[model samples]
Target: MIIDFFSAGFDVFSSPLALILTFTGIIVGLVVGAMPGLGPLMGIILLLPVAIGLPAVAAMGFLIAIFVGGSCGGSISAILLRIPGTPLAAATLYDGYPLAQKGRASDAIGIAITSSAIGGLIGGIVLVFALPS
Candidate 1:
């Protein structure tokens, strides 16, 4: 039954339009994360209303997205303002804060961006395997 759900879910997700929407969402999330006042927490919090209106699987995906976007957004403040937006980014601050203080904020941000992309790639692969085609 779960497998059936996953399969049905994956089938819906496999469409070009669905993929486009997902990618658009990721880009929008990252943009939201990049802003100074719009940190990851705020971004996710703001989206909560929309999440609640979604279906079960969509709501789950949207919530999963909060973390993914947060991973990128949390590091932004650490790299730009030397403040951690999320606790998970406390580790990011160890080197990122110093890097920013030393005028290496861009480098730190670049690394954070790359790590986020790699993670997304791995997640995409896992998602592909997790759902029966």
Candidate 2:
């Protein structure tokens, strides 16, 4: 299965539509996430209509993409406005707002985004292995 995954991933990633869906999902996620109280669950639920009309794989990719980007994007409000955009982002305000106040908002945001991506990757890996077992 692991070997199959690497091979399949290479091919799947080469497809333009997959890339588009992923990109679109990330953008949609970031936009939706910026709204306070509209977390990944809400974003996914709101976009469920798209899933209904699309292939299951594409829909799931989009939903996960949103979850990844949305979680990261929520930090923007936490830093810039000192408001916890989502429950998960409440912790971000502690250091995020301080960095913003120090005029390092961009750096803080960059770190937050990078960290979120790493965290998401870990979560995905764990989810993948856990799903079938």
Which stretches of candidate 2 lie above 4 Å from their native place?
Answer: 9-14, 125-133
Q: What TM-score does each of the candidates earn?
A: 0.62, 0.85
Tens digit of per-residue lDDT, candidate 1, span 1-133: 6679778878866766445545655665666665655656676688778777766556556656655776677778877776676665667888888898888888998999898789889998888679875
lDDT values, one for every candidate = 0.71, 0.83
The sequence of per-residue lDDT tens digits that candidate 2 reaches over residues 77-109 is 898999876777889999999999999999998
What TM-score should be assigned to candidate 2?
Answer: 0.85
Question: What is the lDDT, from 0 to 100, of the residue 56 in candidate 2?
Answer: 61
lDDT of prediction 1:
0.71
